[model samples]
Target: MASENQIVVLDGATARTGTGCMHGISWFVAKLGSTLAGLAADLDASLPSTLMTSIQAVADQHRATCDLLHPGTPSAVVALLRLNETVLEYLVLGDVTVIIDTADGLQVVADDRVDRTARAEREEADRYPFGSAEKQAALLRMKHAELAARNTPGGYWVAAADPTAARYAITGKIPLDTIRRVAVLTDGAARLVALFKLMDWPDVLELLDQHGPTELIRRVRAFEAADPSCMRWARNKRSDDATAVYAV
Candidate 1:
């Protein structure tokens, strides 16, 4: 007789104006035809939609004719996987991250977006005050981005664009046959994940195990309420978009 089968799930999220990354990974996932469309619409259409649409408009005017434009305003997201024994593969454009709880601690996997060019951009920012530098950088980045759009014309990522231009791209292929669980998250969730001395799915699962999803978000709200500074990470560090998910 067959044993109790395992479950696999693939979850993900996106923002309009990242480094044009969600589509690349989403394209791969959609091609794989796994559990769900990696970069689908947000559940909280009322709030996420408004922010995405508003931010995306500003990002649109930023592309250069040579670069790939973001399809819409960047939004955070989370994706999950529930499967028996198999392999897990994933990719990211912006900061959306993947954590694998292996025999070791939480293994954070990310893509190559912050390269030499990105480093140079950062160095330039250091030359000025954080606020003014951010504004100037935003403007310059958008200026070059606009040039890319002109060259590419209708070219853009995932049929959208975002203004902030924050992004990351990361993917992983793992042997799920031995793995116990996996979690996918955007920058927002990452903030909460860091709160723990040990950031692992078991912790998250434990929270979900005791309370429900509502409670998890509620905890986050309460946590945010207490520190409030923590939310700043969601705004400044992981600012663009956020999402998180887990599957065992």
Candidate 2:
């Protein structure tokens, strides 16, 4: 949860193989979030510096625990925030989002480079029937291509085992007094506004204020359940893990 001082949210990379090191990814990300929050609170460090340090710490720990640390070795999206007396600082790495409600309007911050790369694959996969071998194969190819391009100049970046990816984070500062509320959400939960487009950001904030996070995610799940074949939602998976933190 975010308070007057800071916030952090993480979503583990989607894992395929049952034996992949991603089994420990949730643990790794939680630890990394703790490390990041502590640094921001204690040192009052710059956003980039805190992210860099946290990334290195988690990557080293992941390497020590897992025998192999390859591109597929489980990574997570990083969404962090620091609140100062007059402004709010943010660092967003990968697809997770930071949504802010300002006095003027709502602001959304996300990294869509990764999503853009996956779009082509999603289109191809969507051509095949659901639960078919062709669709599965197409999805596999897409994952491989995405893995190959990770951390590259033309490709997108994530908080994987590479500390260098930290430098690629999207960052900015917003005037504190201008903001009425903020929400940090994993992509899964963000689908309410981003992928599903069921409502705009303002509606989302209104829902959060009225019903809270659970009601928002409940609507998402209900929508997915209605379209089992994903003809309506058209996504890589029927559902992904959803998580969110709302602060006011």
Candidate 3:
């Protein structure tokens, strides 16, 4: 979601078997994203505060019917950019990548605490064949480990029922004049550079410059199609939800 002064990108977490919420991930993200956008438009509050309020608002809506304390409750990674006359402010929560093309160079911000946690389990899962029962078991272990660490002080945080998680988001402001362009990508769309190593960040911005965001996502899909069995990529999912937004 984008407005003249603000851009909000949310990648909803895939729903687990029991998310504890009556609504789906799509509904969670939509509600959170729209609420964030509306609050951001006011511009009086900081991005983190706005996000916190938005999260609480969403939680309130579902608190009556849902088990908000469930570990697998719906959540999302967020990337938000707000532009004004003097500065461009950004907030990144979870794995969403926000790349800024500035006069100095490209600046990339991503929260990788999730990757750092459950390392042994994830590595074990990666060692087995994609479709084998061994892989499934390893993957389950990884998920359990991740759940144990989720939203704790030493663990990773995401936008879920807890509004305080917004305070952990990476945030900064840059002089608006120094920025040339900006690209926000969900981890899926960023697989080309992050997971596949097909290109560098500069290459990614260059590709966005020449071919546009669609082309970047197309390349990711092409790579996923080539490695359908995950033999080369060794990913949990053969394909993920890919989303990219470019602003200049």
Which parts of model 1 are misplaced by more than 4 Å? 1-85, 103-105, 111-169, 194-202, 227-242
- Superposed on all Cα atoms, model 1 deviates from the true structure by an RMSD in Å of 11.4
Give Cα distance to truth, residue 44, candidate 2, Å.
3.2
Cα RMSD for candidates in order = 11.4, 2.0, 1.1
Could you say which candidate leads in lDDT?
A: 3
- How would you order the candidates by lDDT, starting with the best? 3, 2, 1
Query: Where does model 3 exceed 4 Å of error?
Result: none
Candidate 2: pairs in clash = none
lDDT of the candidates, in the order given: 0.39, 0.80, 0.90
| Each candidate structure's count of clashing pairs | 61, 0, 0
Model 1: per-residue Cα lDDT at residue 205: 58
TM-score-wise, the better of 1 and 2 is 2
Instruction: Give the worst 10-residue stretch by lDDT in candidate 1.
Output: 1-10
lDDT of each residue in 107-218, candidate 1, tens digit only: 6664323222334443444344324546456536543443343213242222134422212223345676556655565445555565432345567656654664455555
Please estimate how well model 2 matches the true structure, expressed as its whole-model Cα lDDT. Answer: 0.80
How well is each residue in 1-248 modelled by candidate 2, as lDDT tens digits? 45568888888777653324644777767777787777878535778888788888876765655744565777788888888768988899999888998898888998988867766776898777657788789888888878877788978988877778888999999998899999888888888788888888888888889999999889888887787776677777887789878889
